[model samples]
Target chain A: MISGPIPPHPRALLQDLWLEPEATGLAEARPSLKVSSSAKKKDADPTTRGPKAKASQGDLREDDPRERPPYQGNLDSEVFHLESGWKLLASDLCFGKGLDVDFLGMDANRTPIAVLALGEEDQDLCPLKLLDLKAWFQRNKELIRQTWMRICPELISLDLCRDLRFFLIAHEFSPSLIERLSCLSSFDLLLFRLRSLGVRGQQYWYAEGVAPWAHHSQEVSPFEAPSGVEAELLRERINTFLSRVQVVGEGLVGRSLDFEGDRFDRRALIENELVLELGVDQGQVWIRIPGIPDEFLLGTDEEQSRVLDCFLRSLMARNHPTWGSVPLGNSPRKPEQTQNEGKALGGRPEPQPREDRLSSSEPEKDSPWGRGNPCRSSKHAERSEGTRLSDEEMAAFFGS
Target chain B: MAKFFDRIFKPFQRHVALPSSLVPPVVGIASGKGGTGKSMVTVNLGVLLGSPRARVRILDADLGLGNAHLPLGLKPDRNLQYFFEEKGSLADLLQHSRYGVDVLPGGSGLSRLAHLNPSDFRRFALGLDSVLEGAAAVLVDSAAGISPQTLSFLLASDLVLIVTTPEITSLTDAYALIKCLALRRPGRGVSLLVNQCDDSQQGWRAFEKIRDISGRFLGIHVSFLGAVPGDPAVRSALAARTPIVIRTPSAPAARGLRACARRLEDILEEIPQWRKVPSYGRRLLEAQR
Candidate 1:
């Protein structure tokens, strides 16, 4: 349906609609109007250009930062380089902080041919179509396939993914496209944060129906199969993810599922390089990786065990610090064993008066942490130095 | 003709077309920890205190790893790196932000600064002073830890704001930092700002240990400036790359930062009155001689 004359000065109209102070929602919705006229056409002409043509038209005044004057003040010399590129892109870099995905269309030589700036949350408020790619390449699939093959040297071949090349679905994704791109792996299609995915979110796998070889086209192969370096990186990432999950679990009491167990399963997937499992229970999500044998850790290295031991210890400290430290490998705590195991420990304490601790002497030295005392020399240097405020400071600090 | 001539030379009479005497004292936010809320506080406080005429310049001194642009949601047409590389004056590197505040991004490829002779450091300092000549206040967010960059910038600034969280480790490190600065510049103008406080009381209590220890040992009183409460809104705003002062000014954390800004004002007013204690660096050199 026509929204009437479509407001000639669309950005101006958006500004008028958004400056209300209360118009934040509409303000955030402004970037959508920048999409090309082609996006507005029904599968109709299949021949209209988008961001490129519009970009040339200079309709995206917001994107052209030059309109803003350069800062003219005492500036640090080195930060100038990053300031230009560190902009809030019209789109989210990753959708909902889920996956990190890169779509690089390359040439026959596998050189960088084209980089796709995928739809970000703010940019594509409305649903988007993968078919947009056809427009992106001007319906030149063969070239795209060749470029894909060249870029994805590890993938089997582009021809195999012809059927699953690209498709579109009417769906809405939350978080942002950038975040979604961060969590994706060809072998693993798990959603890290299901809560942020708005309704109608679904995966459209272009390589779904293709043969393993076809799906693993040289262009898409690297994404399909893990490389030696990638495998190692994934292992480290999985360990980090497991640690973060354990941290998250500390706050979850009687959660929907065993987050820590699921983390182990994901680690297993990375270890075995076979079978990916993604599931959700209540609010907790799980990705039960398969194929790793139970004997993988028959005699784990001291370093690996130490890391695990430290991780488990931190989790216990966070969840049940007073219950007493549990030794690793005694079998996970059962529900009965988990209850009322110990007193509350490791919890942060309340703020108290501290300035009085100082002697009102000649030096005016008031470091409660003993900034200069020779008597406490050995004990002084070991403490972390991050600032924490006193009670009166906090009160008067925020009260103003 | 006489009046016109007088007006023409009026601006040059002062030798510097500096900002009004009412200009607020520039306070820098620094930390020994990486993940502390230095940038967050600096950006928010700038917005709170910023005005068209009395503008606040947030100089991101984190250099190579600066993230002030991320929290403020601003993208510059040119960054400070270009200025440093091209021998551009600090004034050349200043970039206007979407928010009303002005910005002077730190250089990223400052490995050169690492090897810079004293001449280069002097030129850098002069460029910065020129660039900041007319600002109402300059809020510097320094790189984490005691790198040369952080120390150089910290020493150059009029006031230093040390940010830390409530963890014991963080507090301990904060005290060590105070001790370092005190030992280096015994009476350096420094203040403490606590972030991610469980409560107002907790924030103050967290600084209490450091305040007392520093007072008793170092013979220095690092002012307990203020604290920002642990607010999820701050994180969400950061995730979205928006400043919370604009997104949710009424939030506890925002309010806290504003209060700190005010406290900073009061502290700044008292600076000239406080005796300048020789930085320990100077004292140590003298002692060695």
Candidate 2:
């Protein structure tokens, strides 16, 4: 400390004089001594390092750890613990009778589990391995209990036989193996895929349930997407209204609205003859009578009601004459009387000239039933042989 | 505890009373497996029971593969398909046969009604209500097997006739059908009719076997309706396009059918007059309402 340059301090002079060759020679001459010296250095100094030194010193890590080699085969036991809550209790557990388990572990529920790992090439032997695991567990239940107790003393009192579960872990499972394992619901199947990290012996392991994939192999129709709320509401309203109105001759007639198409035509028939045609297009109801030239569009309530009333009255009059005799709104005659009327209608030998009978009271030419009917005329009477009822006749029959 | 008590006491629950006007006996004819002549039995029975005094309406409820009209030599102008399409009333679908039986025909491919949604089914059932208004007895010929459509008809009927042959497969399937029915309706009684048997003894043996199995496994007693012997005349009458009971009244199968009809008539008479309710269709429609 007493000189022109302080003689460069003895430590600084020693550091500058020591070259790479001398350091190499010294390390070679005393390898153990040098290691022990470095170890001592690390232990003696607690807080005298740069940021990098402190960071490296805080955790004793190597760029690569020897224990974690690249998992070329099935995953190491620790990967399962990290991924699926499998705590390895023991590895290569053996009983005295030549029975051994690959790995013995505990699940998150503290249930003892036996796992067997198979490489892709050994996937065919899964069933054999499963059988072996089951046999080993059966043969060495007491040994497994003791081993579990030794590893986890807190769970020592757990029932090993009742709570034991078995799992098969493999690199890749064939579809056949998965199908076979799916049927064996007692065993859990885990499939692993290996991803190489930057390090030589390290990997990222992914595992999934193979049984679920096998169980859900059946083809299913995709769910139909729901119609929007407004469309559904409109449909519900239409259905409600249709349910209320009486569909005349509903069971005897064969007419349906083709809702999927742009236009639909339904021909209403009485006695196997088309009497009225109904068409629906662009939210409009079209009514067409056989002899009428104009198509009536039922757009409003009054129009719809009028058309429905006309259609029902025509049908009633064509099907039953007793409809005219029954008082308006009173329950139609008893079923027996209706049957009698039907019989009488069928048995009549000649058509009653109701127009002629009314002609004495009112001029026949002025009567719609005789001459002025829109649906029936002299030509139509000649063609239909008088089977068809005129609109005026139907009206007279309906007492309207 | 409440569930346990309910399980124990469920059988003791009283049946709700039904109105007398809605109580016409509905006889459902069914076969577990196809091609066992369920429709044949239904048609013959209808013909045997048909009269001015006894109004018999045969409803061919076989929505698919209905051939009830074939043996009658009459083509149906209208069928249940018309009812579903809302073109005709149920009354228009009613056809009168020369044999005095009223036939409500079912179409061959009219399977839409078989898969009807609840609302459409209700409407169809209401249509049935009007058709069944004046019927004294309605015999429903249900489609073969235990399909939901067939089961609905069977469940709604007052009496069920299970028709089967002496063949082993037929007997086995018939037992399966009976098992399903017994599981669903424990207290409902079923009658068995063995057809195509070589003789009365063979039919009786088959019936006994089924009765034993049903008693042991299902704990249900099956009533033995009379058996119809295998007769070449049945085939002959079928070839002639006529019901065996009508065309060949003296045939062996016809005699057996007459006996069965007589027995059914006796049973109907034995029922208390007050218990005679309206038709099943009417009751079903009323229930829906």
Candidate 3:
């Protein structure tokens, strides 16, 4: 995946993602994104590549962040730095040159994460900006991983380059944006809610996970949650194959067979290691072995059975003890095609009531329990023409 | 209890013929928790009420661990063991103290007495009429906890008094017992007597705690009879195998017991004619079914 070299200066690459021209003034300790000097030399002959960052970052960020720019006055971004099991590698770091991304950190898994905040208004190009930035990260993930590992020393694992997660912070999101984002399922976007307390000017802040979701690597019981509508659709799609899976799984004695949302997994009951997993994402069914990181897209029945059996026997033969830490792979997504690949995922949240849904003009809605009865709120009545009475009949009542 | 009544009402109602004269105010003393001086209160109340004008008999319905006789300073040659065996009668097993309080000794450590079947209850009630004869008031000392057997005895009585201490655990259990009684028979009010209190105020506070909760949640009245303050004389009297009231009349607990007895009399006076006249034996038999 490390096909091309990055720009001579990391800040220039960062400008392609998060360029804030108005935010030119310097502040105390605004850390820059660090890349090894060797990577800079190898990737960019900076003289030629300089124009691309200027074009994309400048064009995309023109309309955004007009209303509420990222944290003004006494507001600080320190709340994003989790205290335990996390390391803040670089703060306010730029990738290519002048483009400054927000805080950059590494999670417990040593996965490099880039964070960006969308302001309250003027966020029209957030989706496009994020998608393009994700493409940029994907193109240069190998360089970022290798260089960061050499400098940071803590990132020992080889699999750290598999994903570059993002934290896109905003007070709220629009529903259409959320739906559009859900259409592209591979991008790992875990939403978080931040609560601020204390006086207006000097506020204390804390962050909490808004949606209960599993990590990209489903080692921690994968639902890798899809909030509300998507969660329901995933459950429904997976349920369509539950009986068949159960039939196939019944013969396997020492396996922990279970289905959560769109993913069905079979692990050794003793080791709790992933043996086989089936899941659906945007109508694509992909399978992968725990020890083997390759997500094998399933084809025909004969091909699936052959590939699945071969992987199982291989897993049995090697039986790696560390396989328990491997992520769950899943559903028969659409025709095992390439449709799921390269599909961009970003903002798609509409502010919804967390409890009993309010009544709306929309025809019918699924009950909170998904398969339960449809909401039967009052419906609009049909109108009719008023009947006219004769003068004699009217006079009988009036005693005329 | 309803099912018990359903099964036995028709059968016993038709078979057993009864004279209406055996109705004295039946006061059942129960505590949801044990060791709150329930038996002591029963014995003291029995002694205070027992007289030539108004005779009182203590029914040791704490059948498994009956100690009413122990406090009354009486040893029974024949306890409920013989009665359950169908060898001796209930009235015959009744032993009287020097204070004129009659004591019915229940068999100690007898698991059979802990859970009485419908048939066993029927056999026991065979002698209830004789025991009730000429009695002005019958004080039933029921076993602690809301067991079906214990509940039958308590529900069958005209009045139920929950004897509890000032301790929170004791109050909670008392509340649980009151809740059970209120649910089983709504509007059938239960009285609470706080036993072994540090002071009168402590007892009153405990009573108010239970009364407020039971009245609010259960929608049934929990009457506070009175609080018996703890006194050293009460322990001495119990050790001497005599009720505190008889052993030391000036004792604080004895005085509180007397006051509660007076209150009991006033409450019993308002009892309906039907309640005073129900055949305790047949009702218990029905409840046991």
TM-score of every candidate: 0.39, 0.38, 0.39
> Which stretches in model 3 have alpha-carbon errors above 4 Å?
A1-400, B1-20, B272-276
Is candidate 1 or 2 superior in lDDT? 2
Report residue B46 deviation for candidate 1 (angstroms): 1.1
Q: What fraction of the true interface contacts does model 1 reproduce?
A: 0.09
Residue-by-residue lDDT tens digits, candidate 3, A44-84? 32353343333333343344544422232223233333211
Cα DockQ of the candidate 3 complex: 0.01
Per prediction, fnat is 0.09, 0.00, 0.00
Over the stretch B1-289, how does candidate 3's per-residue lDDT look in tens digits?
0011111121122112333464666899999899999999998777655542244778888788788889977878887878877786787888876554787788888887878776777778767877876665789999999898898898888889999998877877787787567645654567889999887778877877776555434434466677888889988998988777666654678768766764565455444433444578777876666
TM-score of chain B of each: 0.81, 0.87, 0.89
Sorted into a CAPRI-style docking class, model 2 comes out as incorrect
TM-score ranking, best first: 3, 1, 2
Interface RMSD of each: 25.3, 31.6, 33.6
Q: What lDDT would each prediction earn against the true structure?
A: 0.44, 0.52, 0.54
Candidate rank order under lDDT: 3, 2, 1
The numbered model that scores best in DockQ is 1
- The RMSD of every model to the true structure, in order and in angstroms, is 22.9, 31.4, 36.5
